[model samples]
Target: MRALIAAAIGLAAALAVVLTVTAIGAPPGETSPKPLRTTVPEHP
Candidate 1:
């Protein structure tokens, strides 16, 4: 269980680093490579 938790934390850290780098290097006039966004439906 300890090992599993460590692995999950490591993976999350690596992913965050990669995403930050990608966002910084993204070219102007282009959308983000991965849109970390969510949308909600409108109600009447």
Candidate 2:
């Protein structure tokens, strides 16, 4: 029972870390290669 409780706490902490990283965007050594296009080009 105690082991199960500890496992659950560990899982929650891992999830929290993942969520925080995702909220902060890309990590230090990586970045987006291209900027997003917000508008469509006019037809020829």
Candidate 3:
């Protein structure tokens, strides 16, 4: 019973993270100025 509750909490946290990141980060597309995954390192 405790294990099941823990699993549910973990799943909720994972989903929250995914949702937050998705909301904050722009999707990779032609309209976006930068790509999601860039090979070049930041100089600054």
Candidate 4:
């Protein structure tokens, strides 16, 4: 029982470290400006 609890704690700690590292290294979202749309005549 003690061994199982220890293993679980170790696994949780490893996962937490991995998640923290990934979150910190992730890229930022797009911030570029969009082009303006011009009105065009409709064709029949």
Cα lDDT computed for each candidate against the true fold? 0.89, 0.92, 0.90, 0.90
Pick the lDDT winner: 2
Predicted candidate 1 versus true structure: per-residue lDDT over 2-37, tens digit per residue: 999999999999999999999899666966699674
In model 4, the Cα lDDT at residue 22 comes to 90
What does candidate 4's lDDT look like per residue over 1-44, in tens digits? Answer: 99999999999999999999998996779766986659786889
Best by TM-score: 2
Native-to-model Cα distance after best TM-score fit, residue 12 in candidate 3, in Å: 0.1
Candidate 2's residue-wise lDDT over 1-44, tens digit each? 99999999999999999999899988568567998889998899
- Candidate 2 achieves a global lDDT of 0.92
Name the regions of candidate 4 deviating beyond 4 angstroms. Answer: 26-44
Q: Candidate 3 clashing pairs?
A: none
lDDT tens per residue, model 3, 1-44: 99999999999999999999998998676676766875777898
lDDT of 3: 0.90
Pairs that collide in candidate 1 are: none
Supply the global lDDT for candidate 4: 0.90
